[model samples]
Target: MTQVGEGQEAEESAPPVMTFGAPTAGEILAERYELVEHINNDSAGRLVWRGVDVVLRRPVAVVLRYPGGDSATEMLQAAVAASRVIHPNLVGVYDAIDEDDRAYVVREWVDGQSLREQVAAEGPLDPARATAVGNAVASALAAVHATGMVHGNVHPGTAMISDEGRVVLADARTDGADSQENDVRAVGGILYFALTGHWPHHEAPLHGATAGHGRAAIPDAVRDGSGAIAAPRQVRAGVPAYLDDLTMDLLDPEIAPPSSDVLAAELARLDIPADDHFLESAGTLRFTAEPEDDRSPLAAAGGRKVAIGIAGLLAVALVGLLIGISIFGGDDKDPARKPVAQPSPTAPAVEDTTPAAAAVRKLDITDVKIIDPDSRVRDELDDADKVTDGSLDEGWDTQSYNSAKFGNFKKGMGVWIDLGAPHTVKSVQAVVSAGGATAQLFAGQGNFPHTSSGDKQLVKNYQPVGDALEQYDGTTMTFSNGFNADQKYRYLMLWITELPQKEDGSGKYKIGVQEITVQGS
Candidate 1:
């Protein structure tokens, strides 16, 4: 995962001028991004460069690959598709552009080294750190796979650790050159690398993965006659047995690979409860002495009593000195100054305190109704209330259609809710129950169950609250300026524009919403 920083150009096998289409430093693209310097060339011959977004005044990484053929077309399409799915662990794509002979993708720039670099400098990492990295990458893959898409490029080069200690998987190259299984196997490679400082994949598609002899410089797993790669514990000491088995299972092709979602959950269970935002704030939690105010102080009278006890001991120790002084010089010396005691120093300072945030309660849905204006599926209309019944076993579902986009058979479908009265809404959370459902939220002061999408009442009163959430199972949306607190509404809608693939593989699709909870006053 080598990144070309400013002024650190990567070695180019082909002439720079020819590979980059003669673009020079300071050159502007699409009248927005300004190229600063060429970073490096990927195994696919894609030229990565450091650039700046003039409009946003932010740093960006631009990947450009030339001789647009099927590869260029696939790159641009994949970039556009990947941009539609957003998750915290995935790199954000800003723009994807295609010219006649070239294509470029502008994306968020990470300010840190790659996993490969991290391992190289720090040697092998502990089991906990390796599991944490695996969990992050798996989580990102789950989000990608949920959209019915594959992140064809999952390698050490794509796993990035930012300066903020955030691990994100970047550069989703869905060129159909790889499969979901390959992504799963790559996680094993990451773990093996973290524990043994080696890469097990000899045929990795990325550059710099192997030495001149066509083999990984450091081999984490050596193949046996049975074609099963040995576990990490065989090669590295101090590796936990559970982690070793998990890594071996992931690497062995004979063993079935778990889905991204399942893998993410398993790794999360094994992860240590340490902060991942060490770069954003203090790296770790620490203890400090308590402040003086934190302890109960005794009354002044109590302090005098303790001092008197100490004074009695001092008087006995000084008795011999007092007698000798009085006999030697009765009137020569003035009376010795009375002994005094000092109070204890103030207590040490206490650690800073941060207040906890208030919890958001779910608002009850007063009434739920099927708002199928076109009467697309009158059969399922009676089951609409099942969505708010607080039971996942039985909930509202759309009629199955041949295509995910409703087979172009009817207009969109949705569930409308009545709050009983106007109330300021804060957020809307939905448990989709199934994958591949694309939905959105809207608010308005409309009459109940309009007949059509172009109904006069809806057109005059309805307004969109949050943007579309594509292919999600559980999603939460906080309304923005369009649905502010001051602009309260009694009616809300959860509209479905697309449905997920059929669970039975029938080439048909349906949508299931187990629950819908609104958080507001």
Candidate 2:
């Protein structure tokens, strides 16, 4: 990614203007796509238009560029590459065509505005919403990277939020300059922009702004006297410390950014109701440095000796520290050396000095309900309460399906739990009948009605606490370090997205939750 001024200086003193005939609103391209309305011209001089696919009878977006022979090669390549990846968070590419005069690419038409437009219209989003956006973008990038392709273009304008609250990444550029690492870092930039309403990476040009031409539509990030960009917490109030640390670490060149999948998982873990103040027991972000090469001759000789010397010193220090603790800080008394003193009966009894918050105990679940939105019969509703009945032999189970994803009939099913009152949660552990099922933990406020419509609304309202356990291999799954210690949760949901194969070789998919235990203060 080149800086704005540097990019401008590299261009010709007076660049020639290339022309491709203008397209009319009613004109049809490739005899299949009918243009509806013109959207906008991008910084790279491509025209974007909303169109209709006559054959498919659906809305589409067409991107046109001039001089199709060689100038449009990269654009066409990117479109073809993007078409191969099918993900909910990625804008679907339909077709790419090259005419003698121009080339055009048609993709899915989104009904909502871009991130840049949304931020400009309203203000910065809350921390929870900003985290959701980041998670979506990272998930899209992970899908693209898995196919061994790089999305050279990733910015606020390329990220779109539809009217139905679906976030999609669009307009990939195959310029051969951007790397997978750059795509992952751009997600951090997205978070910064969503939380602070400012773009942190000035080197990457925005959608409508050409580098070195003029100021971008979005404002640059604020910096201190030392020329260091301010963190999200510094720019805005109420940003969580863990989120702030994760955002700044992603932007820092000194710290190695996590892979797209790793970053997506971390963001998913942070996308919860108590995200504003929740802190992970371990550090928010864990970065591992490249291991040193021990094959070198110098390392084999001097490194070994140095490592031995350090180990010897550490061992001696450990012994000395233990002896000092026993002599000066030991809590037990030596009964042989000194007689023990008895307590007076008149003296008041000493109360338990342990803090209540430090202890982890099983929380009483007031109620449990089956959340099966797609099933009209509600076959398994009766056994919902059995999940907390202190028995593992009999519990709730979903109907067996031919496929892992509920036979493509619905999204998922879940068991919703309501604690008697708000409590600081420590962990949630679920014991299933078999392995290979995928599930996630969610937290929210208030319970919805037990109807189908209410179940749909419940799914929408409850935010995920951590990443889904993708194809878990064991019988027990535990979600820990995903809650805020300062915040209490009254409602929780364990949504199962994918089911495991039945053990009896029935050639069907289903899973049963034998028991669910929650530990809290």
Candidate 3:
């Protein structure tokens, strides 16, 4: 449950209890319609059901549940309030009522899979794909924001990518009425995960410019910028420099302090040259009385999103159930799900395309290019002798969390710190295992906050791709795209994963923190 603003109802520590009654399918709501299947649930523990308007025989979703006390009542009330504003991207509320100490609030059902599934199977998505996802959800955000409501919980896991390629956001204006920025921050989080195939905060923090600098540029509450970030090209090849630069720009709130709608519009504008008609805009979003017959945003098969009633969602409800790790990975013990392979030496490195800030210094180790080198990948390591036996002392920290779930050092495991105050950090660098042959950096988080860490963006001014540290271990590369002279840091955190035995030639998994140097003004 999220914390609401002044006017909204407060969250209750104890939620309501719901029991699935043996109500036969076709049972009508308040003896009105024929009940169908269960859809979803509300705060009041009411079970929503699909039903047929027995009188009219039209499809409808009905809400019925065992209610909690004040908290449950308030949640139901909030849903009723949200029912006032209707948007294409938002779920529509039908009605609410209390019966037998159970309060039920009905809403439109949506047909789609959580973004969580897509990311889990495909790993970090491409920038264009990510933008597409973000744009769809951003439209929803725009509508919610216009209504003075914030989708307090917005992320890949929460956003439903319908079969129609449209993203629908749930839990809008539910029990929480947090600040609008909370949704903005959430957008930032989802964007990070989409690109990096991981959460933002699951990884580690970078030695940033200065806490004051990060604060000065970004909103005060968002302090998840891990100092070091990876450039996008490091992960895959053929990525246009323009797309890379755009993602990096969004990472820094100061770079382009625009709203999601504004940025989304910009992306839509980019799509004009290629295919203008596909662009989503107020004109294209024609909402007719019945959304079923409409076909927009093409998908291969289950690509269309059909808005149903509250009962529809319950059929595929994943309430109160979280997988081993978040789609945007979190800081949990690595449950080495599978084995990953080490990156090949011949893997070509992409040219760094990160833009430079006139006011800051740039740190580029171009002369000392890193491909398949030994411990120290410095300018002096040009010779083969130094590459092999260069390391002085090192330690290994391998987590035996869950062997079946979290694969070897991918997106989930990394370094992290809970910041206390502000500090000035210069640079952050580390070396992860190249990886084994079985698994990949699929579970890896962006260097900043790890990929899926919601509410935890690291290195305040870095992108999820190489713009910020996006990859860890081998089979992928991650590092600070550029280090400026005047860096900022308030609190610093670090996330690291151990190189498995197969990846590093030995099982003694460990992350090498060569050094974390701090610079002060």
- Would you list the C-alpha lDDT of every candidate in the order shown? 0.67, 0.77, 0.43
Off by over 4 Å in 2: 1-17, 207-216, 275-521
Model 1 ranges with Cα > 4 A deviation: 1-20, 69-71, 205-220, 223-228, 274-521
**What lDDT score goes with residue 282 in model 1?**
18
User: Model 2 misses residue 56 by how many Å?
Assistant: 0.9
Quote each prediction's TM-score. Answer: 0.48, 0.52, 0.42
Ten residues in a row with the worst lDDT in model 3?
A: 1-10
Which candidate would rank higher by lDDT, 2 or 3? 2
By summed lDDT, the worst window of 10 consecutive residues in model 1 runs over 278-287
Error of 3 at 490 (Å): 54
* Maximum-lDDT candidate: 2
lDDT of 1 at 165: 80
Clash total of candidate 3: 102
- What's the C-alpha lDDT at position 402 in model 3? 20
Q: Rank the candidates by TM-score, best first.
A: 2, 1, 3
TM-score leader? 2
**Cα lDDT tens digits for candidate 2, 204-317:** 445345433342568889998977899998999999876787788788776567678767756765664554323222222111223576566334323444575788899999
Q: Model 2 — TM-score against the truth? A: 0.52
lDDT of 3 by residue, 1-521 (tens): 11111111113544535564546675555565566775443332345466665665555556554543553575566667668767776666676666655555555555555565566555667667776776666667777777766666565545666666666665554555566665665665566666665444432211112211121111112233664445454544644554555545445444423455554454443333444332122121111122344555332111221332233576446542333334435444567543344457999876779976444232222111111111111122122221123243432233321221122112222233222233333434333333431211111122342232221233222222112222222432323323343544433333332233433443333333332222322
